[model samples]
Target: MKNITCIEDLRQIHKRRVPKAFFDYADRGSYAEETLRANRSDMERIKFRQRILVDVASRSLNTTILGEPAALPLILAPIGLTGMQHSDGEIHACRAAHAAGIPYTLSTMSICSIEDVASSVDKPFWFQLYVMKDRGFVKALIERAIAAKCSALVLTVDLQVIGQRHADIKNGMTVPPQWTLSKFIDFASKPSWVSGVLRGKRRTFGNLVDAMKGSNVNELSVWIASQFDQSLNWKDVEWIRSIWPGKLIIKGILDVADAKEAVKTGAQAMVVSNHGGRQLDGAPSSISVLPEIVQEVGGQTEILFDGGIRSGQDVMRALALGAKSCMIGRAYVHGLGAGGQDGVATAIDVISKELSTTMGLCGVNRIEDIDRRVLTDHLQTNAVSSPRN
Candidate 1:
């Protein structure tokens, strides 16, 4: 217990340090959470085929995401309200990721603004955009990202409709948290988290503050719900691609039909995600659907997988299944919540070590060499056999 070794250690520590509501926000999924549970369970069921008597030294996790070199085939996924996790949470996570040689994604709904992360980190990070009905604002947002020199523009295509996470509504989740008696009492108990929150300034949604004319919480709520474009379609992607001349990544592709459509968009990459199982409760887990999507459009577009990624082996599983890279949302969030930038670094370290060691045991030294042959009996038939170049 003294030496934290796994993500669950961070999550348990995070659960005690932060308010229950925010923890639930990061940890829980949609109604019933069947898909959320499945993400992990299905991944665990994929038993690895242990190999030996092969040279295992000099293993590497280095790979490219969207053609950019990464120290590891992992990206710190964008999660909203990261600042609440541990003062300037996005900035801390960015710093940790940069140091760890992985890319960090900043969310549109992040507590820290786009500029905040841009100014804080030295290297270019990815920016995730939630298509809003306000074309004018969306255009400006794109310009801002361009101005910040964000390396990639990640277009999150899944959240046209926000799924109802029962815990969030029940907890009355809000940024610059509302101080109801129970919530206040819970918040008061965690002095470390409170200190972090108080010491920092970018508390609420920083990107929206100036854009919404510094609107208050209630007004901001109205603006958000009204702005999320419910009618987002392929036409809009063309519109965005025309305007934003940069590497484009479409997040949240779960179906073969949708994956095929996404490939035709000329997107350099697509994340196979179900919004971390937060959108549709009964939908299949990201790993479960990854192979089908790969079969549909594997070589046509770069495939990045997300949802229920807990460890380095999870990363290995995804790669063998044809994913070029994997994104960890809750895994690193647990780290961030548990110990800020240190926690994030720790999360990355744990995964990197796990991945390298797993590769050694599997007789795969280079990440690029990881193929379907390393998987158990049933998976070898469908696994990618070799990582994509």
Candidate 2:
């Protein structure tokens, strides 16, 4: 733990500690993963304008996200099957986020139920929603989040139809992992992981278990597959707004036209994401389209950035392009998978320190002071305007 210096260090530990199926589930993307590769490559292209002889002694990372004060401009992005990465993973991640004074967003597909996380953490974390075919069940989930006092409702609008993740297909991924001789050996190899899961609050999807009272893991998977709601449209956002009655964030906006529509929906914020390249393999990277979307709707509504944020420099890049805050999924998930709660804290600390160092070197002492000026050579401008493959 003391030797862990970067998110990649945690990721290496995660791959070693967790089962291969769950580790690859968090590490890989769908189809050819072209967009997934681009998300990182494009981010790496941006270079900072290192300034010297400027007094950055009073540097501060404090900023407000969604009108709420935060220690840093970061939020934990929602990830499905998080608890599989570590036992009670959502609760542990939420607690880590709260202790750092940053908000955590719990996925609807989490192993720990909304109530489980809400009861464990004193702060009101955010809740992410995936609108299924069953409107009644969806409404019930919303009600549960409200009852749990979730600070914000993040509506994921991209995954109306599931993408073909070849890795998951090849791995035969399943909740509680399907029993096979090979799987038994894999589980046996990671005794600590098995022990933690045995002591976990629930083995299957905590939120959906009650809804699937007599169903097995296979039956639940089939049901969830059948409930993706292919007919989902913008009208549904209006419907959700009518019922949710709180801060609403429309996630998965990556185009200028959709950004306009999200602004029209009157959402408090909209995330520019490509579902972390899990949905559309050939789509543009989120950061590449961020400037255009922000230009289109920056003032009308707050724009949050998602997709492939691995470091604090990435967060600074997103903010410089007009994101109110950045959300991270795989970075912290790796930490959770590595060492549970303490690993998550380490992930946050690494990024926070990196962001502060980046700010100081770039001659900025405040979060708002970050902008295009911190960058050198207009490198990002070329990337944003260049042709996409």
| lDDT for 337 (candidate 2) | 98
Query: Whole-model lDDT for model 2 versus the true structure?
Result: 0.92
Worst 10 residues of 1 by lDDT: 380-389
Encode model 1's per-residue lDDT on 195-270: one tens digit a residue.
8888986778887787677578878887888888899999999999998899999999988889999989999999
Candidate 2 Cα RMSD (Å)? 1.8
For 49-86, candidate 2 gives per-residue lDDT tens digits of 89999999999999999999999999999999999999
TM-score of 2: 0.98
Best by lDDT: 2
- In terms of TM-score, which candidate is strongest? 2
The pairs that clash in candidate 1 are 371-385, 372-385
Off by over 4 Å in 2: 378-381, 385-389
lDDT of 2 at 296: 73
Every model's Cα RMSD, please? 2.6, 1.8
The runs of at least 3 residues in candidate 1 whose Cα sits more than 4 Å from the true structure, single-residue gaps closed, are: 378-389
